[model samples]
Target: DQQVKQNSPSLSVQEGRISILNCDYTNSMFDYFLWYKKYPAEGPTFLISISSIKDKNEDGRFTVFLNKSAKHLSLHIVPSQPGDSAVYFCAASEGRGSNYKLTFGKGTLLTVNP
Candidate 1:
């Protein structure tokens, strides 16, 4: 079973609008959640992350909100631009870097129309 799930396979938004991507998880052991953005041919780049202890984390125009009790998380991009179009992924880990592996969601393709 996929511990991390992005129910929406894709999303489309107009430039300067807000783009929201949602994710869900089944594993309660997950203590950390991360969001990554991937271009066509490059690898996924880390965008932001939140610990189970915090409900929100933000970096510039990107903000990630975590609802621990609901096992849900979402990434929000303000003033979305065409360059922001990419595949967004949600990842979860058990908080142990030494031996833990991150579980990734299928991914949500975001299209920011110019």
Candidate 2:
């Protein structure tokens, strides 16, 4: 039933500022979006992706945005530092291959309070 939702489990920013992370999906057949970080030991990696026909996508400072009719998606980190904190997983898939399965969202603990 949880087609993916990271309803602000946690988020604190400071270091350099700017760190917005949010994701929601009711499964509109998705399209593609991924943003993983996870660090406290190392695992999740990725860290940027968006393809729902393209709403926005960057890499340098990390940026990903998609609003396929408001299914919602976001991940922006500008000056945020402190190793970029961790725990940020919001994945989805429904393209590029047909069925690899990737629907995750239950992570959003990005704390970078220098």
**Model 2: residues >4 Å from true position, as ranges?**
1-14, 17-31, 34-49, 52-56, 59-76, 81-87, 95-102
* Candidate 1 pairs with clashing backbones: none
TM-score of each: 0.98, 0.33
lDDT of 1 by residue, 18-97 (tens): 99999999999999999999999899999999999999999999999999989999999998999999999999999776
Model 1 alpha-carbon drift over 4 Å, by segment: none
TM-score of 2: 0.33
> Per-residue lDDT of 9-109 in model 2, one digit per residue for the tens?
99998999899999999999888889999888778989789889899999999898898898998999998998998899999987777557898999999
